[model samples]
Target chain A: MMKQSNLLAIVTCALGLAALSPSAMAEQLLEQQCASCHALQAEDYASSTVQERAERKAPPLYYAGNKFRPEWLVQWLQKPERIRPAGYFPAAHTVPGPDGDVVDSDSLPEHISLSAADAELASAALMKLTPYTDKLDAVDYEVGNISWRMGNLNFGKFNGCDACHRDAPDYGGLSGPELYSAWDRLQPKFIASFITDPVAWDPHTLMPANDLNQAAVQKLSDYLKVNGEDE
Target chain B: MRYALVTLAVSALTAVSAHSWAADAEAGKQLYQIYCTQCHGINGDGKGINIPDMSVLPRDHTDTSEMSARSDEELIKAIKHGGKAVNKSVLMPAWDKNLSDEQVDDLVAYLRHICCDK
Candidate 1:
């Protein structure tokens, strides 16, 4: 009975260690694989080569915990789609205006696939992200106000958003989805990235890059996203 | 006297053609409910259930000022070709494959009637 008890204790210890090893290994692999494109924490890439290229083709993953589902993240990394369709670098291959000056655009290198184990680790590590939720909540705007109505009109008219996207004016060009309620559909982070730098998030998109600064981008993203909370 | 009669006949034909051009808003309202209400909402308010899931928001047909700005041609292009053709979100799938050209025309007419009260 004493010998059997010792064997049981060893087996339990071994099982616990084995379970811990994969999670640890996953964290290490995530640090190796994704640290190049995503900032695991704000400081992880603060002075690294990736940080130097702050205007990367992809958004940082530091807020993944707040922004995404673990299952979605896992699936996304395994089979990365062109989420922006246009390409990660929002302004790649765009033509200059009548002024004859070329615009700046970001370029993304080819993506490499990760093994299933590596993907699991990366997802686990990425889920640790959380940022700016307080600020996001503080700045939330009303969607049904007159200002929002005006913004929607401005987007279609002054900005010529309808020139390419298929939003309002009853009829317009069909290059983009109608913006009648984009705010409710897209992830806030993704919207912010697109608003901040289209080319950085997508490399092959045909949408012309607007010269919107960060503040304006956030405002636009907020306007688009604040509508139809229940829907 | 014969020329006057011919002119009157042409005038009658023109009137008929004009009347035909006037779309049936009632029919459009029904069609919108059946086909477009999924994304565009029951009252063209753009609050449909799928609106949240879609990357692009459906247009609110009630906004006359915005609708007035777009030409009929532009609207037709979007419906026939997907959003990508116009540098927009690819989420708005092309209805050309599913809806006939006549149906698209009717939809446009319906949009004008609902949005512009035309």
Candidate 2:
């Protein structure tokens, strides 16, 4: 009876340790590497001024779960790339050129790449971060198709989003982030929310709040989804 | 003394009317830096940082002749309503949702300062 009781005690202890290890280890990894630059906490975006936003070292990951798909986040952390070609704020990264101001890509820092194991752990932790849960819940998205011609007209001619964001690789404007892989990278609800009200996510975001209605925002999000799949 | 007082009153009235007519260019400048500079360029020269990838060039606010040709009403329409409203490229988004009517007037005043005031 005593032997059986000791065996049960050991099993309970092992299970307890197993449950604690992943979260504890993930926290250690995040604190050691990501704490210096990335904002892991929910920030008061409404109170942050333009100048303050411009000076942010890295994009906030407090809403990572809401913003990024788990697979994409894991992959991205493993093989880091420049998502915002001109850095977070294009204005701060520009220099004089013959024709006009040019984006100084060299001035931007390379995103620190993580090993596969570390990336998996980091993404697991990041995927649990849903500080903007209410914002995410507010947007409801269904997979829909936008025809190439109609999508082009809406994105370029009507809404003028192509003026800043890239709809495809080497296509559209350069000021905003490339949207060619948006479907693969971002959550649909997050995309819709951002398009509908950019200021709510980032108060000083250069992307103008065009005040598009729910249907309009969905249409635009559909346009992006179809565009992303093309590449 | 009566004649001097009449002249003084007339001068004061003229100053007040002129002041009321003028919009706040300084406030407009701040708004421009936030909303317009991404495509319009920092100096309003049409060659913004995004110019490399843009299909259509932005309007150069420094072009005095081009700006002078456009009336305040047309300019205001273009700013408040999108560029499509003025029969131009739709690349310019409408600011009606974001900016107030008074703010639009201030932006026009700032545009005038940049182009015509030298």
Candidate 3:
């Protein structure tokens, strides 16, 4: 009976330690690396003005949990892309205000590279973030006659969207990636980030900085999100 | 009696023409909302989501100076063949395959209504 009791205690202790493992590793990564660029928790993130300012340069991690697909996040952290071809700032000299500013402050440190283990831990912790209540529904915009034809026309002539993106008619410019299927590929918030501030994704893009009023941004995002349906 | 009959006939023709034009205009509005609203915006203000990331800002459909410079044929060609046909960005795809000639006409009429205050 005593042996069995000891065995139960050992199993309880092992289980408890195992449960603590993820949090402990996540805590270390947050303190050692991620805290410099992101806010890991909701309470601290809400209270943190410094972190908010830092976020002006990089995407905020508080919502990372809700925003990213785990597989995609892991891949992206391994090799970051210039999602915004334009530099993160519309202008180099000005410190961007939060409303439409996409630029991160120059004072913030450059992106730090991570080891494989660190990347996995950071991604795991980051994916635990859920900052926003709303989630975008992925519906195929190309299915209906009105949306499909209209979306096609808008992609072609009325807007001149094909200029920088390669998939358009002449495939003339290289300023932006071929957006032939960006809608099916990218996350909604990531797309929203571009709408909010083109420079935030890329500070050096040749693309002009558009001043999109809020409502227009939402509509455009809605349209783009559905543009490249399943593929 | 003959004069009265002629007047009635002319009036009926005019009414029929007006009704047709109205139908075209209505169709145009629906088309505009479905496609043009994204970049040109609901009000044709040149503020769309992709607008910010573009190398050249979208044309403000409401700008009289810009619109006045463009002929209806030019607009049609631009819409059909894309901006590159006119030495502009190829970012605008050619909609020849997507919109029928009649639909294009309807869209043009809609553009006139929204941008020219007609």
Candidate 2: pairs in clash: none
Candidate 2 residue lDDT tens string, A1-231: 579989999999998777878889898888888988888996675575445665677877878888999999889988987777777767777776788977887898888889999999999998888878899888877779999778878888788888988887787777788888888999998999988877677665667676688878878889888888887
Model 2: residue A214 alpha-carbon error in angstroms:
3.4
Error of 3 at B75 (Å): 25
TM-score: model 3 vs. ground truth: 0.38
Cα lDDT tens digits, model 3, B2-102, are: 99999999999999998987787788876654445434544566654345455665677878778878888988987777667777775555665445688
By DockQ, who's the top model here? 2
lDDT of 1 at B31: 49
TM-score, candidate 3, first chain: 0.48
The CA lDDT at A156 in model 3 is 46
Estimated TM-score for each candidate: 0.36, 0.79, 0.38
Give the winner by lDDT.
2
Report lDDT (CA) for all predictions.
Answer: 0.55, 0.82, 0.56
Q: Name the top TM-score candidate.
A: 2
How much is the lDDT of residue A170 in candidate 3? 34
Badly placed stretches (over 4 Å) of model 1 are: A1-23, A43-57, A69-71, A84-108, A113-121, A141-154, A158-231, B1-118
Task: Estimate candidate 1's alpha-carbon lDDT, on a 0 to 1 scale.
Answer: 0.55
Model 1, position A196, has a per-residue lDDT of 49
lDDT tens string, model 1, B1-118? 9999999999999998767667545555544554455445556765443443344677777799988987888777776675555666654445554455776787788888878874
In the order shown, the candidates' DockQ scores are 0.01, 0.36, 0.05
Per-prediction CA RMSD (Å): 19.3, 7.3, 16.9
